[model samples]
Target: MKISATILAAATLGSLFAAPALAQETLNFGIISTESSQNLKQEWVPFLAEMEKQTGFKIKAFFAPDYAGIIEGMRFNKVQVAWFGNKSAMEAVDRAEGEIFVQSVDAEGNPGYWSHLLVHKDSTLNSVQDVLKNAAELTFSNGDPNSTSGFLVPGYYVFAQNGVDDPKKIFKRVINANHETNAMAVANKQVDVSTNNSENLRLVQARQPEKFANIKVIWTSPLIPADPIVWRKDMPKDAKDKIKTFFLTYGVAAPGKSQDQVKKEVETLAGLQWAPFKPSSNDQLLPIRQLELFKNRNKIAGDANMSETDKKAKLAEIDAKLADLTKRMAALK
Candidate 1:
């Protein structure tokens, strides 16, 4: 009986020691809603499986109906890591204790991508001018509020610069949807114009050629930085190192990899519209921060509802931020 009791006590102690290891083996990876969850999963599953194989963690994909859901998930520690555009990454960094560890490279070797304003091929809106001039008669489909290419880039370069404070107020109707839905809506004539991105439009072209055939680009914004991979700042250092190593090496031609293995890995990245990953930090968000400040400045400049005294004070504040950002950006150069 004494020997049995000692064995039982030893086993219990071992199980207690094992519990945390088991817990650490699972990681929830959040994916923002760029398209339908089904489509996103189709592109991500193989890559995530590879990550699981490499890192020895049971990787699960977490999807939300909107960008904010992923942000909130990370805030609550339910999501350990995520892929986020510059604007959304800023939100995550500022609000969710997230840190950018890596950025995705474009498959075609482009340094960055562009935001697009799309109209149906059959529509008369051939340019940004035509759309703005006819805003009173058209329904505009914008993107998720948190989207960088879909929202912030266009919001600044398109409407804000034109002194239009709100597209919803000027257009006949305005609605928000994801990149895929926006492209589809324009193709189907559900809306006259919508915002999309070059990367996503390429996917539409490949995945739904018929829809692609019906779409036309009316305007494209300046180049925007590639997307970033963010992990919660509080994640274990060992886990973070493993994840960083996985991203920085995946899809690259390694010495031991067979030609077929390299080919398959490259193809998987292509499906996600990315090349191998590059190391990045929160500094990647500087241009996005500038864009936001500019947009806010425009809003303040156009706000007739505010007293002149208040408006001037707000504008001064934004200008101070812009100047500081400009100096920081210049220093990087």
Candidate 2:
């Protein structure tokens, strides 16, 4: 559902501006590059400028080379704000005491996206079942192991299902690369199939339509939660409040000449004119949580030398836990 920020800000301008200046300087926003730095700068520079202008503080965007780079930045507390995928976000929160503040809504206002398994148009692969049977013979391209749609989610949903008994023993090869490289590898026929996010695939195709002309989606996973914007524990409290306010109410109509400017800012950040970011919580991240449980179970099963009874008991425990996880995930709004 879409949220409107203008309605919330009608209370008073004094409250929004009550923060002290000393606290504002401590906010350093970090953005992970799912796309290239150049592309990210193009899309986010204006948005950052608008946020700084509105908040009366200089908000710097700390760009990272890759997923690992961002993780390191957050771990050291060099970054105060971070945009993270579900898997990487969990890592950031666990290791850096980062808390999620905001999540992006799609053009349709949905809070999540999906993982897609794609193949070349002329390939004989027709379904997920077909791909699994020939898994050993085909070269697979997965994004970083920490990636949500790229690796963790896809692996947990697909490979982990077979108990991860070293599934690659059935596969010809596996390659871990950035999402863009994974797309190119499949397009160039270097890999027969690869896992990617539908949203990112759309962005890639928008940039180079010809490269993906021969590729088609073969499988799509259940809706995965969108990435989250997180804040470090060491950040100044007033600055944190200001950041949250700006994110929550930036796009809604404001009185006087600022109304048009607010609308423009919203469009730049969210691509939907005058739309507000709704309140989100960890509860919406149930899919990623489920994936984590599946991974843990697979690790237990992969133990090289387990007694027959212990193996059976572990298997039974996994089934029972998974059933509970499924029920909880389904119940999440």
Candidate 3:
């Protein structure tokens, strides 16, 4: 009888210990490597602290050396939520079980940001034309393959449109790095030219004014959509609701927030280079998808090694996809 009683007590204690573990879930939030993890953590820690306080989930920040790391993290269910640029987010949604729930708004109220081709202020390169014309003489610092502004935007608008499908064939040397590193590389003359974005340039201006001053924008791509916040579609409904509510209300003037509270939240958001979270859906990826297809079409058309028959068939497939995307975009409008 004593043995049976001890077993019952042990089971009860085990259940008690496990109940809190089940109730208090830990959420890992992944941030793509736009800059160094240290810089990102400085801008993100306070905001994540607030998320923890408001959502009642233990929030942890996850950073990767490259954008693909975060995408793979979500694919394996290691990251519950993440902030992803358009191109990476498209990859995530298509490859991982990811869904876009909210998007960032620029602190300056701009609807979107521009991608830039940068050179040292003292460099002779004055435009994209000059860079392309002199490509064989200059070493180029490119953005990560997964970066939209760093690679995709410029890949299409600059190289593909000009009939140069691969940068490696033209440039003397091609090196890939994050925006911050690329900007600094140009400023320090480590590379002749590199890709960056308006948002990160603003950060460089604030963090390293001297470097920012030495960098000149030789060319700018058309506006790219703001970044998106994605979470695994399998995230619990209650957790999703809490996360969405926390983001949408964080910097906004809510009824219960004191003036000081609102001001503090605003400043926190400004540090992150955003205003407030706006509700978003997968439809935000439509423009990015169209851009990808357009870039592929151009590449196919420019490929000299491909047979005419194969090129025609590949281009036709990309064109059909582009047309379908166009129709979907029109329907949205």
Please give each candidate's TM-score.
0.92, 0.82, 0.92
lDDT of 1 at 17: 21
TM-score of candidate 2 to 2 decimals: 0.82
* lDDT, candidates in the order shown: 0.88, 0.72, 0.87
Per-residue lDDT of candidate 1, residues 1-333 (tens digit): 000011112223234224346434667788999999889989999999998887877778888899998898887766778999899999999999899999999888887899999999999999988999999999999999999999999999999999887899899999999999999999999999999999999999999999999999989899999999999887766778778988987887777768888788899999999998999999899999999999999898888899999999999999999999999989888
Global lDDT of model 2: 0.72
Which residue runs does candidate 2 get wrong by more than 4 Å?
1-26, 165-167, 255-259, 270-275, 302-304, 307-333
Preferred candidate (lDDT higher): 2 or 3: 3
Model 3 lDDT, full chain set: 0.87
> How good is model 3 by TM-score?
0.92
For 179-270, candidate 2 gives per-residue lDDT tens digits of 77777787888999988887777777777898879787888888887777787655556767778888887676755538678767666865
Top-lDDT structure, candidate number: 1
Candidate 1, residue 104: Cα displacement in angstroms equals: 0.5
RMSD to truth, every model: 7.3, 7.2, 7.4
Give the better candidate number (1 or 2) by TM-score. Answer: 1
